[model samples]
Target: MPHPQAKIHRMFELVEPIATVTFSEVVNEAFLSLGMRNYWDGYFAGRAAPLGLAPAEVVHAVFYNFADGEVARHIPWVWGKVTPQEALAVRERASAVALRQQIGEVAESPGLVRVADLATRAAMSAPTEGRALYAGLKALDVPEDPVAKLWHAATLLREYRGDGHNAALVAHGIGGTEAHVLMALALGMQAETFGRIHHLPKAQLAAVVDGLRERGLVDAAGEFTDAGRETKQRIEALTDELAAPAYDVLIADELDELIAGLEPIAASISND
Candidate 1:
């Protein structure tokens, strides 16, 4: 049996995107307090702030999979405006508002808290295993706001899974720009958001894209080639494979139902 935490991680994968997608409005609002004009700038800085009020380079190192050079341009500007704690507080406040919105819609939806309960069990059972990202997210003080508790559990699973995914990518000899390119292509990332969030220079991004093309992973138009598609799929499978063992605590049926139960919440928030 895989670790119970693995099942939790998989289940959370289904729930995590909704959290991020719905967070945009709340995130934009939170950045106002941090003096950031843009959401990406505020987001990266706010997120990495927990790692420390460190330099751009230092924060980049701690950030794991981001395209470093593109973001290196602005992190100093961001860190200069807010201390790590302040940045984190702003993030939590924004998350709290978003959480409230998400949960309230289901005020009458039966078993609203069920997903949170299941995720909490998985979080309680998962081990750290020297993953810094997981540890940092785990150390965050859980919000007592009833609605926020569900978001808190979902956040933990997302971070834990992300940290482990990076570890798996590294083990496969993927790193730096190539890793970012591979992920961006494999994950079906939106071109507009990718450019904005990664902030990679055109020349640098071009070079990586050119290299991926040379290796037959992408085509002239920058879409994934057949091989590229396969590579991306493999990476995701391996990521899930690496993350799977954590769910041994639940039976397959329970995991299935948990995913089913959360679909409506995701659907409800899909347009939000």
Candidate 2:
């Protein structure tokens, strides 16, 4: 059976282009960091149906506010200072930059991959898979940032064995970081790459390793402990169970229709 959450996530994917484009607009206008925008956009978009915001409204808010001077100050130019034409031009340029950056970030961030994989698994699992994944996440006893909490859960579930390394590495590269850096060390990246990709120094990576070790999640050599391995497995299993239902619902016919509808915009964005 496909997991409820997995189905839900795939359903969400049907709307990802809309959400992602909205997010790009918001981040570019508000001057919010790429990380912060990704975190909020994912959380909000995922929960939008339950939370009562039209997905388009969420995107609108970011741009409107940025133009109105209501948020972050790092955007290239203040919204009010620019003419309407200039704003449009800037938004277009920024949108292009944001998409490429996001792809790169997704390629590099191990925590991101871990979360995505588990989410994929949870979606494949059962109706109860999302709840179970959330419960496991709660048990981690981490900080309150939802994004960070999600990352911790992903870290706990990641399959760090040698065979899994290549897929993990590819995900990191897409996000624009070294695979070993994010997965093994549980640290933010440091090296600066296209978009917002940053590469971490060796010492900083070691510090992350130490932090994971201190939490009993890993050993001195940065390998996951027995407890970590077990937890990760459980989460992955639950995600897998959640995804089953979604896989079935996402039948070939429906997917074909969705692709037909989405292809134009998706292709335009990619080409831009």
User: What TM-score does each of the candidates earn?
Assistant: 0.81, 0.30
Best by lDDT: 1
What's the lDDT of the predicted structure labeled candidate 1? 0.67
Best candidate, TM-score-wise?
Answer: 1
Global lDDT of each model? 0.67, 0.36
Tens digit per residue, CA lDDT, model 2, 1-272 = 33354433343443344324534554444333323243333323222212122234332332221122222322322323433333333333444455445444432445434433333333333232223222322333342332333323222222111112333323322111223323333332222221222234556545645664676656665566786555444543443443334345454554444334434434444454
What tens digits encode model 1's per-residue C-alpha lDDT throughout 205-226?
7877788788888898888889
Task: For model 1, state the Cα shift of residue 115 in Å.
Answer: 1.9
Flag regions of model 2 displaced more than 4 Å: 1-16, 26-202, 209-244
Model 1 CA lDDT for position 107: 39
Report the C-alpha displacement of residue 240, candidate 1, in angstroms: 0.5
